[model samples]
Target: MIKHYCGIFGIYNHVEAARMAYFGLYALQHRGQESAGIVTWDGQKLREHRGMGLVPDVFNERHLGKELKGNIAVGHIRYSTTGASLIRNAQPFLVRFKGMEIAIAHNGNLTNTVELRDELERKGSIFQTSIDSEVFVHLIAHNMNGKTVEEAVMAACKRVKGAYSLIILANDKLIAMRDPHGMRPLALGRLAGSPVLASETCAFDLMEAEFIRPLDPGEMLVIEGNSVKSYSLLDEGKKPPTRQCIFELVYFARPDSIVFGEDVYQCRKEMGRQLAIESAPDVDFIMPFPDSGIYCAVGFAQQSGLPYEHAMIRNHYVGRTFIQPSQDMRDFGVQVKINPVKSMIRGKRICIVDDSIVRGTTIRTRVKKLRELGAKEVHFRVSCPPIKHPCFYGIDFSSKGELIAANHSISEIERFIGLDSLHYLSIDGLLRSVSHPEKYCLACFNGDYPIPCAGGGCSRACLEVTD
Candidate 1:
């Protein structure tokens, strides 16, 4: 039940830009469920429609076909990490500066939000939303200084720190950029000869767009009327190492997605294979927690020569339980979303495979349910290493205190979850499972943050800057 950060989509010079963006946002709906939005430009004026709900609930045929008429557009699906869950913070944030209108959709948290906001506020710049994403718009607007919009965007990027994948819609151009560390994913694609961008390739798949490639760290592309101009913000030989969030493959992204140029499903399967090789427990059968755990469990079962079964069924309609904001709500959501099959669980030594354990509440509750359903023994297996540090980038894992592994020993966690035994993929094992392991950020598991938070601590207040 890990909370995803956000998803962004943009298209340039497409006649059905708003409709295509709707489909793209629909494909990326799994990334965020708190709110959805889209802003379009019809060569003369900007049109916008946003709401605090799922994609289908927010946009309809009328809004896409008429109200949001445009040949260029940007869309967003948000699970707030930097702001409170309010409609005002729903992104594709549109603003007017010097008689020019611009819209931006962002997919990461800013580490220097507090510092930047303070500096701006002191200089008579009024703020809009509490979200750190609004900082980007302000920075771009104030830094224009006779420079082109693309140049202003790059200049603004230099003033910020931490993970960000951006899709910006100006009056005449659509722009996309990735952070210097590439901590978040942004992909370039094409649909009917028009340039498009999204947080993941899964969106491209849904729209029948061809993925060109993932944007390099610190790279910006200004797309105008099917022509794209690329620029690199980093100086020669001064580029920082790429540190894409490894959790994207383990949990955040769709299994069918190609994130950071690697297949997510294959990576999870490799993780499961590595888990089997490193921590194979004696069990009658392997059962995945459902959905996220299915592919990993298959790999584990295959590697261990054990049968795999769906002991728990998931309700697809229910949103992710981990992002429910409260322990009581998360616990309740888990119960309503997943139910154990009594016939499959009775009198069995079952290994329950899951992606990762954050607070341990959801897994603990599910384990209790299994035991109540007559499971003789529940051995818990995690495909990823223990999350031992808070994520300041985009993930909702905000405090070290919220991470069970950061506070308790493995055996203690096993006892707390009421499992017969528990095993998590080792850090080294998890690293070996991915391509270009050195290019990944594993701070949540190892406490080696690729980018340090502002004021030198990973506290929620320091990273998020909600004020």
Candidate 2:
């Protein structure tokens, strides 16, 4: 699978606004963990605090609630794309531009970010984060023409390109926008009669908020002073970008969240069922890689009529930076990440379910561990199709030759991972699983990018020109 960026979220127009936005972002913490941030507007100004940590660890009932009180607010939990990881890169990017400071939190990658940044820098724009989102502020600073922040936002949108789902906070307004092509996910909601905005409808469900339509793929929705309006920014020069990033269904989003009115959990479950129907394994119990595969495992279990086992129990306490020091350290991290429920796995024929295989280092290691732990048989099942190319949009991976499954056939992969058998969901079956299938861009799996690649795939000229 191509490495994907983190999720983004925000809430607006509620009493105890900042605290409420915190909870909304808290529900979305699974989307991104590199950093978290929140900015609240208390009539006169915006109060902001963001740092690296999980939601609860970064925000608290005492300080987070008291210090961030406002009638309007926006928040973010960021994972970097097109920038190095560091404190300065953590988002909810705030900048003073054209006489007003606006904060922006972004979810998708900007294919043309390098070009935008260069143009802005040549004009004397100084940037704080290595993050691509900083370019939006610079572009806005240079182009804002309206007396109000909303007008400035509209002006800025005209100059920017590529995939973006943004939550932009102005002094008196919260403007949520999606690229005209709708390459990423963004939604609007309402709770207690106040309008709200979030990256997913699932957050709205968590708040018992009524779900509204997603921001039109290229439409901008402005929430200001308790009123809302919409604007179409489509340029005749460009067709809407069609790549919606199929990774969202396979790995990026929390299964509980909904993207573009489609339930993420349901999409994965359906993928598992379709996999079972097509691959029909000669195994006993089905197992899943902890966390991501839980729902798919359930679908596999129900479809195959085999019991699901917690063969590997994951440790919840291990931090992201917990790199093991040796094979023993690696094994120990595996033990911490998941330990075999010995009784459930011992001497049984088993099927393992996972979202996708990237490097295969983790899989090769894990499959061997299962054998050491006494699994009689191990058959592997992947929910998504093989990843043959690297993602160029905003995710970190770009070397096509490095993907384990890209060069290896199923039997070759089975031998490489040391699995008794292996299978992957067909690309067609994978597409059939998502709601509004026609709307998504499955380019990574299918190599069918909806828009022109600025010039062409992997060309330095294209990369430099578009980015």
Candidate 3:
């Protein structure tokens, strides 16, 4: 599975701001699971609740109603892309500087973190956590002298490069900003006449908020006293080209979301349709590996005029911290996560549809189980092209060494995964499935990173693919 770094949600001018932010983060739980936090700004002070676990595990009725009383709130769910998983790295990182209390929740990775961290440390700027998100707080603080939070934010943004969809709670105002490349998703909404912000529109549905629109690349909006004002991060007479993360549509986003001004379900369904057009393997029935692959499998089944079956049953009750079986059990985790329906799989030629293959090991184990179940043939269809590159701007395949396709050919992957055939939606097919395809960051598939990262790129193994 490709793990996204984080998800953020914020609300301003609401009586139950923290509660609403909790629900917003709950809806965005799929984006991260390592940690969860919420910060609330009362008229006179800031309150916080952060813990290392799922939203429900971290927060309760008591935390929301009693501890986090405020009219403004910012929430974060983190999966740790730039820092180790620790309580200290949990966010809606709250800090007090110069009589102003500020809290920030971030939703993307920064490429120049090392340089900025070095510079800050040299200037005696102490860091409390190793997460790159802290750099924003320090930068904003450094610029806070003789400047409004807006000016500080703009100045801080100007110095940093890469993906960020940030929500800041500074005193009584809630601020939202997106990177110039728009490498992450952030949506604007209205709830009960209060302005709200989230990493995806799906949160709006949960909060009963009206989906206003997506925040544009380089756009910053300041929400104060039920009013919103927009500002551009771009220099005058310059509009940066949009290079939104395509992986959000492919896997990171919920199917119910509207990201980058497009419907995620429709895009995934179209990708499945396109995959069928390009590589429709002859099969008796189509199946998905459960939740992740269900929508795409539906599209494949519809396009191929084949039967759609729930051949694999997912154990929804499986907890994130399930007790590990002894090493002797081997594929115990995978087996418990999902089990093939014996009746549906025996003597069948099945086509399994999925979003994308990351490491290929888990799928290989699942396919091996299918063989044990007496399957005639197993064909795999991927809705997106092989992820051949690392992503520095958020979705966590940070090392080319971790990507199977980055080191091996299509046939090699097919053999390794024990499939009769493995086909991926071509790059053109993926583009055809979405609107304004030119605006997407296809860096994971093409290695054309919009903002270069010093510590990220193709590894020697990726370079060896063509050689």
Candidate 4:
């Protein structure tokens, strides 16, 4: 599985704000797993609790129902994309300056983090964490001389350039903003007339909130009580074309969520349909590796008139971290994660459909297992085009060297993975499955980066951070 970035949720003027934020974060747990935090603004003061673990592990009834009492609350779930994974880097990063308190939960990576950090350090701004997100706090604080929180945030947005979906709790006001390019996903919702914000619509589903539309590119909303005020983070002439991350639909977001006005499940299913139309091999049955490939494989089965079966049963209890056995154990890790259904695989020509193959190692091991299970032929089909380039805007993609597709040919990858035959969805087929294809970022597939970085993803070498 790919590494996740972060997820943010906020609600204003709600009686159970912290509890609601907790549920929102729980729905968005897929977006981050390293740490979870929540900060609230009670009438007199701000209270916060942060811990390094899943949402349920970090928060209990005592922490949510009693300690975090407030009408306004902001929460964060983090898997570090910029800094090291440390408890100190846990978010809803709250700070007090000039008697004004502001807490921020950021969802995307900034491109110019190194440059901005240097400038801020020279100006005598002491940094508390080694994260790029902290740069936003410093920038907002620096611009808070005689301006409102919204104004300070807009000024800060102008100085930095990159993808960011932000939820900020400033004193009694709850504010939300998205970068001009719309490189990340953030949606606005409402629950019993109380305004709320989250990284995905799935959070609204869990909170039983009404999904109001997604925030427009570069739009900023400041909410207090039940009233909401909106503003643009950038001037009209300065706004660039929208470059929404397509990977959000391809892999990052949950199928139940609505992202960028598209139903994620339908989008992925259509991708499978397009793949079947482009290339459908003759096989006894089609199956997925479970979870990630399940939806796409369904569409492929329907379009190809092929029977679908669950060839591999995933061990639902498998945790992200597991104990290892001796090197003498063959394929112990893969076997524990998923075991082949030998009754369904004996002498069958099986076609496996997956989302995307990042590194060929994992798929290679699984394919070898299928052969040992008495499968006649193992053919692989991918629903998305080959990922030939690294992603710079938030996604923690492997470098060119590690990305199998970036350095190997289609035939080479097929041989390396021990597949009888392999095929990937064409770029044209992938674009056909989504709306406004021109507006989506295909940089990872086509190598046409919308925003230039320091090369090999966001350069973190200059920053004094360790992972």
Task: Name the runs in model 2 displaced over 4 angstroms.
Answer: 1-3, 81-83, 146-148, 236-242, 320-328, 451-467
For residues 246-314, what per-residue lDDT tens digits would candidate 1 score against the true structure?
A: 999999899999999999999999999889998888889999988889988988988999888988888
Model 1 earns a TM-score of 0.96
TM-score each candidate.
Answer: 0.96, 0.92, 0.97, 0.97
lDDT accuracy of residue 242 in candidate 1: 92
Leading candidate by lDDT: 3
Cα lDDT of model 2 overall?
A: 0.76
Looking at model 2, which ten-residue stretch has the lowest summed lDDT?
458-467
Please state the error at residue 86 of candidate 4 in Å. 0.5
**What lDDT is obtained when candidate 3 is compared to the true structure?**
0.89
Score candidate 3 by TM-score against the native: 0.97
Task: Tell me the tens digit of each residue's lDDT in model 2 across 67-119.
Answer: 88788888888665443557777778888655576888887666666666777
In model 1, what lDDT does residue 369 have?
Answer: 84
lDDT-wise, the better of 1 and 3 is 3
lDDT score of residue 252 within candidate 1:
88
* Global lDDT of each candidate: 0.88, 0.76, 0.89, 0.88
Question: Which lDDT tens digits does candidate 3 get at residues 339-410?
Answer: 999998889999999999999999999999999999999999999999998877777686878999999999
Assess the local accuracy of residue 426 in candidate 4 as a C-alpha lDDT between 0 and 100.
Answer: 92
